[model samples]
Target: MEEILSQNEIDVLLSAITSGEMDAEELKKEEEEKKIRVYDFKRALRFSKDQIRSISRIHENYARMLTTFLSSQLRTYVHIGVESVDQVPYEEFIRSISSLTVLNIYSMSPLKGSMVIEINPNVAYALLDRILGGKGTSVTKTESLTEIEKILLNQIFEKATGTLKEAWSSLVDVSPVLEEFEENPQFIQMVAPNDTVVVVSMSAEIGEASGMINLCIPHTLLEPIIPKLSAHYWMDNTTDERDEEAFQKLSSNLQTTKVDVQAILGETRITINEFLKLGINDVVSLEQQIGDPLTLTINQEPKFYVQPGQLKKKIAVQILEEIEKGVNTHE
Candidate 1:
């Protein structure tokens, strides 16, 4: 039964269908859901200055000195960036991150190009050489970088995780993982966005050679880790516990008062020739007398006159009288 409907009937049917459901409330709910932030697990690599400095110390005992060397060698400055669901622009992110008192971002590049950090060629070569324990001048040809050279650079950064763990202890467990972007689709996708990339560049001086170090981070790859890094810097629970324990142990110990004693009585001068010529039998005269109220010093201070005596089996001193006048004078 195939019956054709008239135009009026079709119109009426369409109108009825349209009027049957008014989803204004559902549309509003959908809009609100869209407004909610969707957290991505990939954005967990963003680290703070404290976290980076702590990590940097793992590479060298002198973190600040190393940083200065890096700056001088690289001829560039380090930068940090943060991105949220708000889609912060690259320049804005650089400005915000560089505003941190410690790191200084010299120049921020535009977000139009591929998410790659730009480092000075000379600095890169110097850094690579230094990391490899080779002379900075050893790197001659840029095209001569072998597969092993690339691997070494990667290893240097990867080893930084171990350094950070040792310094910070169990507060943070950060491991640098290198995934080949060419083969991994996820890696490429992670860096596809314009606002996702953060660049950290620094010029470092390694002896006579000056070089640079540049790091690139995708915004979505670091945002989640920011809180953890911040917590590691500000709320170090383990250190606080250790400090408290040390304080408790120190406070429980008994306290003792110490007495200080000192005295400058008198001085005498004699000729060197006379001293050398003196024989064991010869008598040497001193300004002090044998029994002219021998100075009785209590704690090295002249307090009373005392006479020497023998009491039972031991020699003793008897306080004749207290010297209440000016400094005791001797002939």
Candidate 2:
């Protein structure tokens, strides 16, 4: 029999189609999930959230490495930190540095252009004094730095670059090659004047002396590596590798556990009366051949058969074969 829907049912169908409620609700749900994060192009939105997170983590590592490196180099306790990671116009970054500063121009390969790292003159002079065998002290603002001081500063910046290389190793291999050294900010231009840059501002403190650091990484140079700069990309690719590494470490630790080992040369049975009447030099024969290998046990389990030997001045055993449970090869 053919069944027909009631008029009320037909009206309900028409109402839903007219209102577009069914698909509209589903479409709204999917779109809402996709649009959760709000992005702003005004702040130079070249770096996504994941990219920012990765950059921050990497820079923290750099701060720690630089802290240890400088502390050891200057023979004193030093502290360095990543204060902020931000994006701004190259001009703004240029304007932020002091008139007298140490600017390190460097390049990262596979990247288009160069970057800048600025160290406060106070910190530079402090490092120079320490390197020259003087007590690290806060230096007064000087009108100018000499050519010799510039040369010494070059070596210091080189160490900073080395630390940056190590910090980026887990994410990607990078080599920071120095391009130039400049004291005047106006004369330095690694990229266009108004281009966007990722500026990593940091702070350094040694004893009572303290100063700031700034790194200007141009956006154009970092554009090519956008896909690799995200958090999800690394977490997905390295999870299994981390698990394997942890497992290997655990297994290696287990290999170092101590075990008690002893060898049984032979076995013998004696009567109680004979035991009581035994003398100091009394001879008792054991159920073993003169040249037979001894059974070695580890933690109460028979593990190997070995022959008695003398190694230098110590008694030792040469392993003849591995022993299995309930199996006697010699017999």
Candidate 2 residue spans exceeding 4 A from truth: 1-43, 242-331
- Predicted candidate 2 versus true structure: per-residue lDDT over 140-168, tens digit per residue: 86677788988988887777788888887
- TM-scores for candidates 1 onward, in order: 0.35, 0.62
Question: Candidate 2, clashing residue pairs?
Answer: none
Which digits, one per residue and each the tens of the lDDT, describe model 1 over residues 127-193?
Answer: 5766655565424453534577557655544443333234333333443333331211222333334
Candidate 1 Cα misplacement greater than 4 A, ranges: 1-120, 127-134, 138-140, 164-172, 180-189, 225-242, 246-331
lDDT score of residue 68 within candidate 2: 91
TM-score attained by model 1:
0.35
Cα lDDT computed for each candidate against the true fold: 0.47, 0.84
All-Cα superposition RMSD per candidate = 18.2, 14.4
Model 1 residue 126 CA deviation (Å) reads 2.4
